[model samples]
Target: MRQLNKFTFNICPTVSIHNQINLLSNEDIKYTFNDFQKNKQIISCVDNFSEIERDECHIYFCPYESKEYHKITNNFPGGIFIHVHEIALFDEQPFEHKSFFQISQSFRFMKKLTLINDKRSRKLHDNNEHLSIIKYPHLSQLDLSEAQDDYIEQFLVDTKTCLPNSFYLCCRLSSTEKSDTTLCKKYNMNKLFKSAFVMFNCIFQGLSLFDRRFNQLRVLHVNSSWIRYSSRLTINNTENLPNLKCFSLYCDTDTVVYDELIVPLLHRMLDLEKLHLYLIIGYKNTFIDGNNLKRNIINHMPPLNIFTFNIRTTVHLHNLN
Candidate 1:
């Protein structure tokens, strides 16, 4: 005689497939929703998925389905993992499903989740209220530079866990914004841009809006465009970051004001230990040269007995590629 043990459970989707064979009989297997008129148990199965033990299930689906599973598993030990590609399939459900309130309730338990794709569903997941429950001490790594700024910013805001000690971010501003480039009349493009100075000021303002989550940041990197926008003006409250120790900035062009903006900001970062900068082009031939840039910044930034400052300038090359 074979004895079945109740505690030995298979919670993986692959294992669930095998269970489906036993749980659903030949008659029930034949009744797909498309042919449900012939048999009603399939609909009963879909509607009453809760009848299964909370600890005996695992679901694999896109963000929306993952969100639904989160709602169902809040009391269960394991959480759901999102698959970015299949989200649209769940989203394409007949109009009735879109209006279903049960789906919304199902998403309310979504927390401590890992987003798997660059899709908008990932963005929506970041905004979910349950995100703050994410346990930071257990987090191994996170890569957010490729994510949209709105998602990236909100994720940091919702992050209750200290950021991992090491990570990589490759952030670049969108090049097509009329405000960053030129004015145009055909698309009312000039109005589209809020003006470079205003956009620049907003970068400085964002630091204030940056929530206390920044206290966990130990190392920070910024591309030239981020500097162009965020460095256009210096922020005043940087002293709030108690753990910050290293900073790096890449500049598109050698601009003296970059130093001006950075010096004052660094003055507030007392724990700063190392600073590095890469410039695409050396300072525009003018009164300020590398020597002046070094002297002026050293006078205002946080004191450093041992640190490395290196600058690389690039020039237009002929067809090496």
Candidate 2:
């Protein structure tokens, strides 16, 4: 197959000639060109290359340090999944020198990209143009953080295809809460995409998280520490998320958000099938309006297939009993 690069080469997930599809176990260990002398095994492992079966190689994984390796992987005829340290945007660095914007252009055939980064950066904001080139109908998953709303809005409106099926944002709650609300408020979630999965890990204030209707959203995941008081949390918009199937929420009681918020939010998700909550109970004494809350929730949302609840507690359950 090495000699068959002339034709479209496709590699399946099972083919192990080169462990290119699955990332190397030790790839997460930090290394540098200087450390190559002592880590020959690691160096040789990354240096090895083989002809990719273009048809089967829909997913590609690359290290954050290997700019040259990415140049080669980008040639694959299918989607590319590259490991990244973070969103790669550079001010003075040359475009050819490992910028996300440049890396994106390298794979014109790529339909989806799954970037793995431990942190978020403003570099994603700098790569707006390259991100727009994505063929929306083909792209399945996109995981990014600290991306600007202008770029996201443009993607929803300008694309010739539907938005991605699943989107993830991993970011610090404090940083985004102060800057993101205004930008996110300007866009209409219902009009953005027909059916989608959205996940966010960031702090939100006011109705930033609930004000907008998600008409086509099927799955939703949110991990935030603080909560604000807003009926938007309790208000249901069937026209926005008519088919919501699953919802997972993580919250702490030290904030204004509470079970009170959940009931109202539950009422809004008319078709919710599964519910997962991670609630942290603080020292504050509180009463459970369980009957009224559950009644409202059951009245609005769909029957559950499976329900899982995890509540952090310092007091005994018998106390509530």
**RMSD vs true structure, all candidates:** 13.5, 11.7
Best by the lDDT measure: 2
TM-score of 2: 0.51
TM-score of each: 0.40, 0.51
| Strongest candidate by TM-score | 2
Off by over 4 Å in 1: 1-116, 122-137, 158-216, 229-242, 253-256, 281-290, 299-306, 312-321
